[model samples]
Target: MTQLTTIVISNVKAADETDLCISIQNMRLLRILSIKVTNEEETLQMDALSSPPPNLQKLLLTRKLEKVPQWFCSLQSLTYLYLHWSRLEEDLLPHIAALPHLGRLKLTNAYVGKQLRFGTGFLKLTVLWICNFPQLDEIIIEKEVMPNLKSLWIDSCMELKIVPMGIEYLQNLQQLDLTSASRELKNRIRNVDILKVQHIPKRYIWK
Candidate 1:
């Protein structure tokens, strides 16, 4: 208990008692961690959230996860990460860019939507939420490497066909949510040049 903050391990917590996850990894301030290991039929190997979260800011891993556990690349005081239908990928983005005060990152279907293979990027991601990844193939926003990405939400991927083409090199991108695109992939969306874009939400509003 290095001044432990908060930890609630009870989705009936039982990672097969692997030493109780190494005794909460000797809790070091442990900012706030909520895990609910449901029906763990043996696929949950966090390797200890990839060994970071020492003063873990806020991490909520809920349901359905099969892999992506290599101790999350040494979490350096992880800011906030919420994973839903976890089967995580995108190599976990160098363990979330080495968590230099990570802002907020959320994944519903969990895939990183494949792209932004930032090999040391995410200069402290702002807020990114990727939902229902049907195998993302677009939504690429990077301003010389995530210089504090503002906000981006791509909903219901459905094999997303065109959006991630460098994404205007995001310069503190404001907001973008494809709104579960499907209208022929929003009639070939490829307009780039968005910095503080606020719309793109009310999906397919009659194209």
Candidate 2:
């Protein structure tokens, strides 16, 4: 039997209702695992899968999970993460920022919150994207966080009325991409917030 390094389950009906906590610790070569359900009513309890493979680098969850599995924090080699419509209530940024080598992160309608804050210690991060989070009105970025970040994208956040606070601290940032933002927010960026991100080399704004 050929050893499988990547496993992806997408659009599987009732995938979330199934108890799929299989242990993959023996799959030492596994690097990517993605599970996406077709029905929003179903949920997957990934906590059943304890002790992930050491080489796991990318994890994508498209189901309606409440929170990220604690076991994920142990995957030090993980670099890219994408969560779509996970409906997480708690802020996962703090735990995510602790990832030693994480580089890119994308969230689409994953959070059920009004704000998202980024603290310190994202040394290797270079790209970030957040989209379709309706309740998210504010984003706070503390200084020294994501020092190596170069590109950022925010889209379809209708409630966000202004640019993220502390964006100026991303000294290495080169691009800021915005789409489907409120008109007022766009106006502020062009007028009131221009100086805040004037240093960035590229700006892409789409109405």
What lDDT is obtained when candidate 1 is compared to the true structure?
0.64
- Say what the RMSD of model 2 is: 1.9
Model 1, span 1-207: residue lDDT tens: 656788776553445546556656777667888776655443445554335546778888766556666676566778888887665654566656766887888878766445545545778787887777766665554447777677777777767766565555665566666776765556565333232232333223221
| Best of the candidates, lDDT | 2
For model 2, the superposed segments whose C-alpha errors exceed 4 Å read 11-19
Clashing pairs in 2: 16-43, 21-48
Please give the CA lDDT of all the candidate structures. 0.64, 0.84
Per-prediction TM-score: 0.35, 0.93
Decoy 2 TM-score against native? 0.93
Local lDDT at 85 for model 2: 87
Tens digit per residue, CA lDDT, model 2, 118-190: 9777789999999999999999999999999999999999999988999999989999999999887898889
